[model samples]
Target: MKHIFAALCLLAAPAAAQNAPHVVTDIAPIHALVTQLMEGVGEPSQIIPTGSSPHSYAMRPSEARALRDADLVVWVGPSLTHWLEEPLDTLSGDAARLTLMDDDRAVKLPMREATELGEEHDHGHDGHDHEGEVDPHGWLAPSNAVLWASVISKTLADVDPANAEIYEVNSKRFAEEVGALEQEITAKLAPYHDASFIVLHDAFHYFEATFGVEADAFIVAGDGSTPGPAQIKALRDHLAEDPATCAFTAPQENDSLLRTVIEGQGTRIAVLDPMGDGTTPYATLIRQFADDMVACFSQE
Candidate 1:
């Protein structure tokens, strides 16, 4: 009885001494991805809360606290979630920062003119230099997501060595789900034989390219800056002549601005999200995006 009790105490001592290391991420997609990776282990506490724009997000006190307290920090690198780059590096010195873009194993997609592949509906080019650009919206690519999952799995193992097996198991299962999602999206979007959509922002270019859809126009010119009245008017006039069935924009977009410029146009405004806001499982997010696009086209 004494020997058994001593062994039980030794096992219990590790559990008692170990802290449940906190994990932090910039946006919902990474947050959800990490959550899926740590599903059976523990959910990661997100730095940027839901409905927040990661590109221009101002770090808050509580968010800083979360970052400082986290034992692990996973982000999509400075280019994508640019705002978080400096602050995270500064605040969370001890935390393990895993970047999908810097993973070395991630699959990269080439950048091209948004109008090049989409339907030939000229919305008047602003001559915005995309000369040697790479897509910033890399998470939209499923293959990249798989690479991220692997990075996350390895990082989780680094943070919580004892639970390495659990992390590996979760990563494999999640990778399989992402693979299935890619296949399903390809199949569902195969129809519409000839369909393309317009956007208020160029964020969806990667998504469009991946799913074989096209973005015809954007209210914003380049680098997420809004176009002037003349440019918007030109786009409106172009759409009037060749009305797009749908005009999709980000969830965090200004509806008043969208309506003001796009009013009297026959196009329907559909809110599309590249990030998995208010959703779980990366696969579900992809499905939601696919379903929304199909629904938009099916409406007409």
Candidate 2:
């Protein structure tokens, strides 16, 4: 009877591994974090393709199927990708959902006002400038990243208790990496604390606040909309009045309007990969972000 029970236990372990839950994530950065937790377990499927704007994306048929089959679906709430909330309800409705923003511990920043140009027009991105709206880019902060690792592990453990230990362990390791990266980034950005720069959008405030290397003005809005003519002119005027050393644009989002604003200003243009470059470890991606900003700030 003991031998039979031992054989059954061995069979059950492999069965659990084979039945590993299918996990799906919304964006590359979130996917990268989930990938770390599932390192020895299984990989999660990413909905947004590489280099695509997470602010707006049309889900592919395959991705839709993945959601339908998913046992767990993790995403930053609709603030960053407003288009995803409906799909989550329809396709991934039955799956275990972890909306990071909904978690109380997730640090939220107030909405940044749109550029001066946006106000001239009746329509604008985050035009109000009031404190109610939350910046969707909260995942960029080191502290927030650590919080995500903890939340993600808790969410994963709730659904897959058999592998709860592994998830918790990976979350601890991820937090450790984030701590070291934060220290490194603080030192890297310290030299630029007083240096002035501009961003094509308001995506970096969380990161900037954490490291004390904030930008002087935003060329775009808190939300991802393109600024109107008035906003562009206002930015040009702002630059004319007080020039900045660099202007940063995100991967897959820069355009002629951005180029038009920077023309003849002699300001260096650099890319900040907020989507984690789709592949590098999340920590490495943030290090790259700091490196990109520092490199641009270092220019003459």
Best by lDDT: 2
TM-score of 2: 0.89
lDDT of 1 by residue, 1-300 (tens): 999999888877644134456888878888888888886677787877787766678878998999989898888777666778788878998888787777666655544453553333333345555656565678888888888898889988888887888889999998899898889999988886367567776777666767788766666633555555666666667666777778787777666666765688667888877776634778888889889888898885
Query: Top TM-score: which candidate number?
Result: 2
The residue-by-residue lDDT of candidate 2 on 1-300, one tens digit each, is 999999898887654467677999988898999989877778899999878878888988999999999999989888888999999999989999988887788778876665322323233443444447888888888898899889888888888898899899999999999999999999998888988777887788899889998777776666776666766777677777777788888876755666788799888888898877445798998999999999998876
Off by over 4 Å in 1: 1-18, 110-130
Report the poorest 10 consecutive residues by lDDT, candidate 2: 115-124
TM-score of each: 0.85, 0.89
